[model samples]
Target: MSFLDKAKDFIDKHDEQVDQALEKVGAEVDKRTGHKYTTHIDKGVDEAQKRTGEGDTRP
Candidate 1:
């Protein structure tokens, strides 16, 4: 399988963990950027989680 396919398989098998990790990564990016891109980061994280089959955790 190609790298993208392997990554997709891994994400599907560990969706919950992937979701949590994405949240953490987004939060870190927001912090590092001094919250200047909080909205963008959150949207990106939500989209990533959705694509990984975790659904949208955002309210």
Candidate 2:
């Protein structure tokens, strides 16, 4: 299978973990950047979660 297909399958199986990891990474980036890029990081995280078919846990 192509890399994209394999990635999709992996993400489908680990969506929850992926979401958590994304959140952690986003938070780290926000902290390291002094929250200057928090808005952009959040937007990217949201887009990534959507693309990965991961459910949004944000209220």
Candidate 3:
């Protein structure tokens, strides 16, 4: 496979990992700074996941 193919595969495989990481990071930030700062943690994670195509849209 070429570089683009390999890169795409990597992203496909690691997308969930990236989303989970962002959730963890966001939670940490919320805990350290207090979520009272008007920042929606869940929304932030959702947006990040959407932008990265890491979000699973299943109910």
Ranking by TM-score: 2, 1, 3
Clashing pairs in 3: none
lDDT by residue (1-59, candidate 2, tens digit) is 99999988998888888888899999999999999998899999988887775566455
Candidate 3 lDDT trough over 10 residues, lowest sum: 50-59
| Least well predicted 10-residue stretch by lDDT in candidate 1 | 50-59
Instruction: Tell me each candidate's TM-score.
Output: 0.81, 0.81, 0.61
* Residue range 1-59, candidate 1, lDDT tens digits: 99999988888888888888899999999999999999999889988889885565544
Candidate 3 lDDT (Cα, 0 to 1)? 0.72
The lDDT of each candidate is 0.86, 0.86, 0.72
TM-score of 3: 0.61
Please report, as a residue range, the 10-residue window in candidate 2 with the lowest summed lDDT. Answer: 50-59
